[model samples]
Target: MQRQHSFDQTELGTLYLVPTPIGNLQDMTFRAVDTLKKVDLIAAEDTRNTQKLLNHFEVETKQISFHEHNTAQRIPQLVEKLLNGDSIAQVSDAGMPSISDPGKELVAACIEHDIPVVPLPGANAGLTALIASGLEPQPFYFYGFLGRKPSFQKQELTALANHQETLIFYESPHRIAKTLVNMIEIFGPQREAVLARELTKKHEEFLRGTLVELQEWATVDNVRGEFVMMVAGNDVEEVDESLVDLSPIEEVVHLIEAGESTNNAIKRVAKRRQINRQDLYKEFHEI
Candidate 1:
């Protein structure tokens, strides 16, 4: 089926959002190469990182750095180039761009300026993990990157725990173990989950079990490489808000009166509420 949009007469340069491999170079799509080769410029999250892939496929396209740190500054420059009739392509470090990654601002700006943006279907770690996860896919949520800083991370985890859809999260190799422990605490020890690591790579492993079991396994083994976490939807029995043993506000007051520091108390309450600690702290103190 042909796309409804008319591409033949549109003057605005086409912006191709290409998805590269999460792992395994052979996963690169043929159309992605053709698009990269045809575009005037390629906006890469990392030039050095993208160079390896470019060399392998022998794509001679010029690449410029466009990432989270510099996307604000780069958007206008890229827009200007696009306005000048230069077709541009955006690729992330891996998977697709604007997927818990930069490229959103650039895409939005292009759309605002009436630039034509085209998305090329390709590999994505979130969907890759989801399909193989054995979890219900239609009703699901993708929460990417539970980075360091335990307080905020736990808050995000807790919110997802209350969600009815299957939850997927991206976690770093170093933090996966700690994150799994946090998952066990927030979602319960019995939540069935899958941890996919080094997907499509030589040592790829998909560890599936309850949160407690996975935590124990990760603790003993040497875990290295990126991870895609798939956790089953919360059991209806688990989400009865009335069953919450303690109201967050009430818990906050109790902890404060028990001599817990304000910061500690707020962190505890926010986790229970599944809200951001900073937001909770401000509301609690009316800051």
Candidate 2:
């Protein structure tokens, strides 16, 4: 039997996942600029937005729109270009492509066709905020964007309230106020939280404190720009050692059988009972 290697840049089409500036144009990496200049074509989530970036860089790479609306139709043509020896770079409006932004479908398609996909890491609002947030970075979850409706947002927050890992989410200026209020209600007013706005821009600000304090500050007028919210996880409540030893596994299974998700069940039992979900998870898997 013979072994086959994956697509190479010289043999197959190269798909570059290029990250753009989150706010400040200067944040664009030197390598990213070089990649854009060298690629045969650029696929942008928003051509207009990307045009401004290209203009700033003076990199004459041609760009075409490849966002959620047109990704399905655009995949074939992009793959064809790659097959024809053209290297294409994918860029979202801001930050990295496919980081809860766009570009997953194209990347998946490229993988199926054995195309060479290379990612050039750069500015990421979520990670940038998380680092500045002073929150635990390792055990954190990224909830890209919350639902706009109050009800949906509330349900989502409530479901995640008891999460043991730090939570990160993105929000627009228009809805930041409402989102903060919902956070206070669901995650408790005292939960540690951080909100970073206008990252890398002149008005960039990192607001840190309890949910209540953040909400209070956000109420002021003109508090606006791209925002990344980092929230502290629920503290384990002390359990009465005398209580019946209801194994966390049993509780998880019970709740799941009653229609709760593994996630929901874990959070519910873990927060209310002060049990480590991971410990129970290990036991469950071992058995």
Candidate 3:
């Protein structure tokens, strides 16, 4: 229950989450540029990439590397600087800072320490693709990136199979074909979907069709660039109980096949069936 007045004067400096352009440089907002220039320090996901954006905008702010690899080490230092009244702006390689990006940890630290976090609205690939997807826009779910592992990804898709809202997913070019294949298996071939690529760039294109058509296109055409895949929601209700027929060990095996850890799968099965956890664990391990 914390309230933040972004512009209010305080001893601690405000952390500004600035969004950069996803593709075209023109999409970089004026406020984002200004905040980048005005902040005492810039925590960037990639300093070299950010330097290019800074050069384009004629902004000469000093930047420090603050990516996924360095988050554990950087968060404390950044928070300390904020406490010392040095305003900081956090930016990712593209789009919003914390949307499937690296700024959320820093944002959490700032909030925990009573520092202000000011966010600037700017380009986002998910929403950018959603509006033009020719699907239901209002009740859409944004699922940024799917798990790389086949089983984990299948599990995730299986979990979302019954969602009535439209679903959004980010996928790399190399894996689009495989992802679509998995989606077809879980969401069916007839589900309407749109694949947006090279968003806001000169070669941007949108392919709208059913899951099977998209898979065919992926197989036949040259699939390049990052993709934003918007899938139409499930219209027909599916039977929710997928694990009802399986024995306790078989249920655990199913979850394990879907990439869940064995111990966790056993615990989940035990809790759901109101069985003794120790007995399930012993039985699972054949002990």
Candidate 4:
């Protein structure tokens, strides 16, 4: 086990994981701004976007591009600088550096090389939306983004169907309607959910209702802005043991009877049982 004492003085320069504003510029912490000004170099997800932020804060620190695409090429160079005692600060375009964003790879590299990595807490869209969601907050699971494809997305939802903790997900505007539809199918229509959008901005709004209602709103309303979707967990205490005895085909048939399409039902059953989806499809069709 390795322990990190962020403030301990060492020959290597510290790597600060600074969080920028999610939407409102006022959300920028004083420490984050100070770190950006003080660090020898700023590694940013997007230099152009970060330059605007730096200009806003009157910080003249030089920035180097450190995004998903350039991580492989930049980590070694950043690590080398850190070893030479040139302090570095990493920031994403908004929010925390590595939560469904770039910076995890560089952080891992720093840890492997025994570099001190300090984190400055600030705005996060998921936690910001969760407190006002009117759902259980303490025991929560943060699944940032679901798969985009229907088959893969439904399979993901199926795995999370039995979770007993609040579930948080990030979704873009274009796919929110489809995601809600899939949630309705797997988690059921009656499950409580909240959708928060344009968080911390002037046009921020929260829609709270059952999954069915959210699905309806998403379908008809002009769904714009990124979304933080918080879903109430499965509260059912009793398990249906009868399902265990059903054959693969029977399980698929059961899901189909419950409103899922045959292809989706087959996929879910195949995923849950750790069997090949194509083989299950073939066997079901043969019978």
Candidate 5:
């Protein structure tokens, strides 16, 4: 286990994760600004946008582009700098560095190289939405973004069906309707959920309702801005072999709905019914 004493003196340079404002510039913390000013270089997801922030704070730290498209190339170079005792700060366009943003790979590389990774607390869309969501905050799961593929998204929804804790997801405006439809299918239309849009901005808004309600609301207009979606968790009893009163398909569906993987659900149901796994799989999918 690696213990990090963030302020302790060390020869190696630190990888500071600085969180910029999600929308409101006032949300940017003083420590974040100080770190931005002090770091030897800033590894930004978008240099142009970060430059605007730096200008706003009167910070003159130089920045190099480090985003998804160029992470593989940039990580090695950044690691080398860290190894050379040159401190670096990593920031995304909004919120924390690695939450649906770049910097995760670089942090992993730093850990591998024994470089200290110090994160300063600041703005985050997920936690900002969570505290106001009226949902259980302690056990919520932060699912940054879902798979773009329909089938894969469905599988992911199936896997998350039975979570007893609250669930959070980040979604773009363009795909909210489609994702809500999938959630309705898997989690049922009545499950409680919230949609927080353009958080901390002048036009920030929150929509609270059931999944089906959200599905309808998403279609009301051209949905705009990034979204933070929080949904209530699975409300169901434990599923096991003793559910003898359930039909094969029903049992399998229950297990799948309760967050059990599709393959595991099929295997368990097949074993309980003393039937071939292949036949049960076929029946489950109507294949």
Candidate 6:
């Protein structure tokens, strides 16, 4: 039942969820750097990694370790600091905090204890790659990462198989190839997809193709970079009860039973099933 007036001057301290650059240092926002300079303490996922960013920005603000391994032990200490009117800013190893990052739990804790949580938007890898992907940017589902285990990953992908919105995911260099293979199994070889990596930096690149093509590309000699994968929606039309029992060839036959020409029937069925009309025609006539 708590509402946050983030900018309001209050007795209790605020938790600032700060975002760091995904790759290029220039992408770092002015406000993000300013906030980092002013905050009482910075809770970083990796102090060593964050030191590079802090050093670049000349942000002298002291930092404490706050990452996945020690979150339970750190939250209480952080909460205490915040409760004592010490404004704290939390940052991930890269990109936005609390987004496939470590700040989510602390944000929840602050909310439960009535501490104000203020978020400052900055560089984000998922959206950065999404806009440039040449895919439908709106109606996007930001699924950060899938399960690590093969069985669990497959189960998760299966649940998302029928989703109509553009899908977004983050994967490590080590797992991208296997993940694409799994995607091919669930979403079919023809499904359109894009792979973006080394975002915002000099090595930034986007590999666009179908699931099968990307699967083959993933096995190339060099598969190394932070990856953001974008998958197209399930473009298939609703299965008509009459057409459900028919194969692609049979569906064309059923359509031909009507007054429509064979070519037109194949076109209609292909539109419904999201397959190539020419391919449908060839398969139908060959049978």
Scanning candidate 4 in windows of ten residues, the lowest lDDT window is 234-243
**Model 2: residues >4 Å from true position, as ranges?**
1-10, 241-287
lDDT of 5 by residue, 141-237 (tens): 8888999998999999899988888999999999999999999888877678999998999899999987888899889977999999999887544
Give me the displacement of residue 44 in model 4, in angstroms: 0.6
Clashes of each: 0, 0, 0, 0, 0, 0
**lDDT score of residue 280 within candidate 6:** 78
Model 3 score (lDDT): 0.91
How accurate locally is residue 21 in candidate 6, as Cα lDDT from 0 to 100? 87
Residue lDDT tens for model 1, 106-136: 9889888878888998889988888888888
Worst 10 contiguous positions by lDDT, candidate 6:
271-280
Q: How does residue 11 of candidate 4 score in lDDT? A: 91
* Backbone clash pairs in model 5 (N, Cα, C under 3 Å; residues 3+ apart or in different chains), count: 0
Candidate 6 global TM-score: 0.91
Off-target runs (Cα >4 Å) in candidate 6 are 245-247, 253-287
Tens digits of per-residue lDDT, candidate 6, 105-127, equal: 99989999899998888889999
TM-score, model 5 to reference? 0.82
Better of 1 and 2 by lDDT: 2
- Number of the predicted model whose lDDT against the real structure is largest: 4
What stretches of model 4 exceed 4 Å from their correct place? 239-287
Which parts of model 3 are misplaced by more than 4 Å?
237-287
lDDT by residue (tens digit), candidate 2, 180-277: 99998888776789999989889889989878888988898677687899999877565646434767777678779889987787777765654455
Model 1: which residue pairs collide? none
Q: Candidate 3's residue-wise lDDT over 89-196, tens digit each?
A: 999999998898999889999999999999999999999999998999979898999999999999999999889899999999999999999998988776789999
TM-score of each: 0.80, 0.80, 0.82, 0.83, 0.82, 0.91
Instruction: Give the least accurate 10-residue stretch of model 1, judged by summed lDDT.
Output: 235-244
Q: Runs in model 5 with CA error above 4 Å?
A: 237-287
State the lDDT of candidate 4 residue by residue for 1-287, as single tens digits: 99998898899999999999989999998999999999999999999999999999999999999999988999999999999999999999889989999999999999999999999999999999999999999799999999989999999999999999999999999999999999988987767899999999999999998888899999999889999999998874453587889998998999899899999988777656646678999999995
What does the lDDT read for residue 120 in candidate 3? 93
